[model samples]
Target: MCKAVFFKKLKYRRDVLGDVIVNKHKCLYCGTCVAVCPMDAIELIDKWVEINEDCNDCSVCAKICPVGALGGVK
Candidate 1:
């Protein structure tokens, strides 16, 4: 209960701190982001890149993305 509440309250920080945002329409689905992510936070599912909480705003994926679809909010 307490932990849940804490997580819920801090959930927004997940994005501000380091969460990676993927723009599906612009994604090339070339698997570059997945391969370049140092934290393995980016995953190529079906035809899109998915960003998990494992990201640390390293920007590796963003820099490596050929289509400029990945962004980290550090």
Candidate 2:
């Protein structure tokens, strides 16, 4: 039998800024960010995707974004 490797729960800093930043004007109503986010923080609303409470600020979504819609503030 194979034993599963248990991992500790991920604890992220609340004040940390995510690397993804959405440009409202440049956005094309694509769901790329929503699909790429591991934490499921982004959601599509009225054809536009928006970040929700589930955001862990990991920046995975930003890195995968093809159009550079999501990026860090700094």
Candidate 3:
């Protein structure tokens, strides 16, 4: 029972920390942001890297993007 409780808490933490968003219109299709994201939450689709629900909003992708294509929620 104790093990089950610990797993449940861990799952909750993971879910809460995962929040990321990307603007498709601003995306440059350079793939630089995708490559820099540590969480692997960004993916290229139709020349834009879409941010998934798993994104942690670390801003790494945005910082690395040369063209300022990626940005997190303000």
RMSD of 3: 7.0
Q: Which is the better candidate, 2 or 3, if ranked by lDDT?
A: 3
Q: How many backbone clashes does candidate 2 have?
A: 4
- Which digits, one per residue and each the tens of the lDDT, describe model 1 over residues 26-60? 88899987887788877778876677778778888
Model 2 TM-score relative to the real fold: 0.63
**Where is model 3 more than 4 Å wrong at Cα?**
1-21
Model 3 accuracy (lDDT, Cα): 0.69
TM-score (all chains, Cα) for each model: 0.71, 0.63, 0.61
lDDT of 2 by residue, 1-74 (tens): 23332221112222234434577776776787788778888888996777766776777777777777776534
TM-score ranking from best candidate downward: 1, 2, 3
Cα lDDT tens digits, model 3, 1-74, are 69999987865565455544456666668888778878888888876566765777778887787767665444
User: Considering TM-score, which of the candidate structures 1 and 3 is the better prediction for this target?
Assistant: 1
Q: Which ranges of candidate 2 are over 4 A from the true structure? A: 1-19
Could you tell me the lDDT of residue 69 within candidate 3? 60
Score residue 51 of candidate 2 by CA lDDT: 75
What global local distance difference test value does model 2 have?
0.66
